[model samples]
Target: MTFNIHQDYSEDTGIRHSKYSETSGEDFYHDKLNEIFYGCYTRNEVLELVLDGGDDGYTPSFLDESIGNLVYDFTLDVVKTMLHIVSDWEPYWIDEIEKKTYPKWEERRRKGEQATITKSHGAWYRLINGVPEKRVWIVYTEEQ
Candidate 1:
């Protein structure tokens, strides 16, 4: 079954316009795709469209960007849940989430750093779906 985020859930058109339609950053999806990204995990179609509203699918770079944001808004586990919910609770979404997006979330979630990112880099970053992010050497410099 082909999925159309805009047409399928017209009830949320207002949200599709304001929240999901923004293009500036991640975490923008923020729990919406809890019912949004099933297509990417199961069927085949637009990943970002459901969030950022467009008519495109799976460009290497776009896929990369969308994955990061999707993990941020909905953890790999949650994305899996969303997909399964659409699949009548089937578990195949597990394979897709595990292969495509889970490792990054797992490594960070275990380390317990999502809170750090939320506090320190919250303005610049879109926090890690309540999980830790890849650790990095953050250096803030001041010049005279």
Candidate 2:
């Protein structure tokens, strides 16, 4: 089945907003086509450009910026869903552990004493609650 993906351009706000239609099995292909036509870059092409350094040297293009934003939004959603799943399982694990070990573990976790998971992106997640608590960007400087 064919689906329609609309890109609305707002003149007042100067923003392009995408409206997607729900499609069952062909959603992946549809989304890729939308990205290529509206966003001007496919995910695989963006990855290839980054890995191959753009066939020669680095040259900035509109496609690069567009794909970068799309990647960021997509990754943020994935991370949020993962955090939700982990958080949902926390109470079950805590209950199981309390039956065997000290009950004060939950109390300590409530007081924000839980361990954190750190990622290369400088994002930190609380292990007990699975909340994305902090994000820090590391800036690199080249020395002459």
Candidate 3:
């Protein structure tokens, strides 16, 4: 059975986020995948759910990050092959990645002060000292 992540994206479940549910869009996306990874839905169903989210339509950010992490178990070639099936839905060109990488936490990584932002594999993570050793958020960087 497929799960409807957003029964109503417009309605706030009181999850509390900087802008919306504290669970960044990417993390929420992962939660859905967990269902797939565990056999709740086949990979194809996962792709279908992604292809159909929101008014602007789900952005690549929503799928790319989660899909990239899939390499932890599935191969880069396998993920690419899956993406190829729904090529039209992707916003950008996603080619084969030689290595699959997950966002990691950095310390004193901001403005010379260490601003670290990384994405985590699952929902809810622990912070190491104040910076998460795991990726939970996406970080924007300035030139060195």
Q: For candidate 2, lDDT tens digit of each residue in 1-144?
A: 121112121111111111221221122222342233222222222211111211222112222222223223233222222211111322443233224222333334335442211111233222223222233322223320
Score residue 84 of candidate 2 by CA lDDT. Answer: 19
Instruction: Using lDDT, give the best candidate's number.
Output: 1
Go through the candidates in order and give each one's C-alpha lDDT: 0.37, 0.25, 0.35
Model 2 clash pairs? none
List TM-score per model, in order.
0.33, 0.17, 0.37
Tell me the spans in candidate 1 whose CA falls farther than 4 Å from its real position.
1-3, 6-28, 34-54, 59-79, 85-97, 115-144
Best by TM-score: 3
Please give the lDDT score at residue 108 for candidate 1: 54
Candidate 2 or 3, higher TM-score? 3
Order the candidate numbers by lDDT, best to worst.
1, 3, 2
Over the full model, what C-alpha lDDT does candidate 3 score relative to the true structure? 0.35
Candidate 1 lDDT over 1-144, as tens digits, reads 344333553322321112234321222232234234543544444343332233432222222333445554445565444433222332443345456656765455456434111111222222254443333323323320
Top-down TM-score ranking: 3, 1, 2
Deviation from native of the Cα of residue 58 in model 2, angstroms? 2.8
